[model samples]
Target: MIRAELPPYEGDTAHLRKMFSYFPSGVVALLANVGGTPKGMVASSFTVGVSMEPPLVSCAIRRQSSTWPELKGAHRIGISVFGEDQGEMARQISSKSIASRFEKIPLRHADSSALFIAQAPVWFECSFADELPAGDHTIALLEVHRGGADPELPPLVFYGSTFRQLQVSSADG
Candidate 1:
């Protein structure tokens, strides 16, 4: 059996991204209504069910993010699970210029002021719970206020440095 030689790892940013790319995660849209303008960004680091008793979820944000400050002021934030067909929308929201993130996208908003993509398979309405710095990022913990899902719309998966679609095997059914 031939074993591949490993590169000398420095445990730097480059290596970290390369190694973590092997683990696929769901793509999510973090949205909020800041004042009268819609603000949002795409995150592959979103996680759910962090605390069952408190009903919490979390998303890791870069410490240098300029959007976090404005979003934190919102009364509530929306987390929309991207569908397999929304890869383009994800990139648009994550772009450098935040001015036009939702230019052509359809959106829905809850009474709590949490904005969401109308077609997302699932979405959560949450309020700021807590956050703590972790290395170069801050984990934003949120307490779920309300959420819903549509099983018919399958979620988008971010893996191997690209957006991929998911397929459920018949055996699982």
Candidate 2:
């Protein structure tokens, strides 16, 4: 067996982030309307089906996120799981310019003010349930009120700091 020596762990942020990027994850947009204005942010650290009985999902949000503070007080939040072709939409929503995030982007609004991205693969209307402090971020639990999925649209994947598409395999292995 060939074994190679690796460097000792130093807890470096950059190194840790680079290593973490190797794992692929689905991206989602968290959107809401606060005070007649739509607020949205992209998150790759999103998990669905956290609880079956209560219908819950979770997302880890950075502590420094400006958009979170505004959306936190909203009546409802929209979780839009990006479709494979919606990578550019994710980039635009996560851009630094808050004012232009939704510019030229098609959206759907609920009576509860939950704003969803049009044609997204999955959509969830959630209300903030609880939040706990995690190192450098907050772990938020959201109670799903309503949700829908489109099986035809493949999900967008984030891997190695880039957007990726899934390739379906043959039925016979």
Candidate 3:
């Protein structure tokens, strides 16, 4: 087999985004009820179980995200890991028009006032842990106070710039 030489590196964000999309990542909806109003955003960069003792999870958001400000100030935030079947819902929530984010989705508000999407497989009740500057984005670290998952639901995966469901088979083949 022969290998071709690659182009020289250029600091282009579009190029970076395209390269990053090659890897599959889980998607999550970050939510909160501010003064009885449901607010949320879909994030594909979410990561879980950062620390066992402190119980930390994290997600990265653009520096200019308008939703991040409202979420960080809330007493508690809800993180709903999208189920494999919730790709369309994730896209709907991620839209720029916040007005229609939860237009037809069922919701759940925790006792702590954290809002979550009802059909998601996993949900986390978290408090803001910290935020660090990371290039053009801010990395948000959250401390998980409580969480739950539905064992039957598989996670939604973002791969090659599209939503996909993970499918694994037994070793019998």
lDDT of each: 0.92, 0.93, 0.90
TM-score per candidate: 0.93, 0.93, 0.92
Q: Which ten residues in a row have the lowest lDDT in candidate 1?
A: 6-15
RMSD of each: 2.4, 2.0, 2.3
- The residue ranges of model 1 lying beyond 4 angstroms of the native Cα positions read 1-9
Residue 42 lDDT, candidate 2, scale 0-100: 97
Highest lDDT, which number?
Answer: 2
Q: Model 1, 1-173: lDDT tens per residue? A: 99999877776877789789879999999899888999988899999989998999999999999998888779999999999999999999999977788899899998877999989999999998899999999999999989999999999999999999997999976
Better of 1 and 3 by lDDT: 1
lDDT for model 3: 0.90
Candidate 1 yields a Cα-based lDDT of: 0.92
Model 2 off-target regions past 4 Å?
A: 1-8
